[model samples]
Target: MTFVVVQNSNNDTMTRRELHQAWGTQKEKLKLKFAALTDTDLLYPEGMETEMISKLALKLGKTKEEVYQIIKAI
Candidate 1:
């Protein structure tokens, strides 16, 4: 599952489908927001989220946590 973010004080969270239901929007926003990002960088194959984030962190010169926060915020 593609985890989006933690929801609230209740500690509930949602996956890509359950939450935004519009990863396309967020993906577009992400590419626009970070010009360095490419479509390949956003690719999320099954069970590859960590690798994807690691790649993003390396490309953007940010920590994984920062990358996660950026994604979550979008």
Candidate 2:
């Protein structure tokens, strides 16, 4: 299986609550993993974390927590 390497200087993964801090990298990873996902689908605006999570959960047919884990894993 091909592995996605998160290339951050710190090599640390951010929590869901901190997704905004690491969103640029996270969104690209999400796009690579799910070609169907578009920029609009992952448009996480400032102060709209819940909305972004809801959108992703709806599109992926997953719970919010699952979505959190998916982001964390990448």
What are the models' TM-scores? 0.69, 0.72
Which regions of candidate 2 deviate over 4 angstroms? Answer: 1-17
Candidate 1 lDDT over 1-74, as tens digits, reads: 54665343345445645434556687899899999889988876645556777898999999877777777778
- Write one digit per residue (lDDT tens) for candidate 2, span 1-74: 22333323345444344666689998999999988899999998676666787799899998877776788788
lDDT of 2 at 56: 94
Winner by TM-score: 2
Alpha carbon deviation, residue 4, candidate 2 (Å): 28
**lDDT of prediction 1:** 0.71
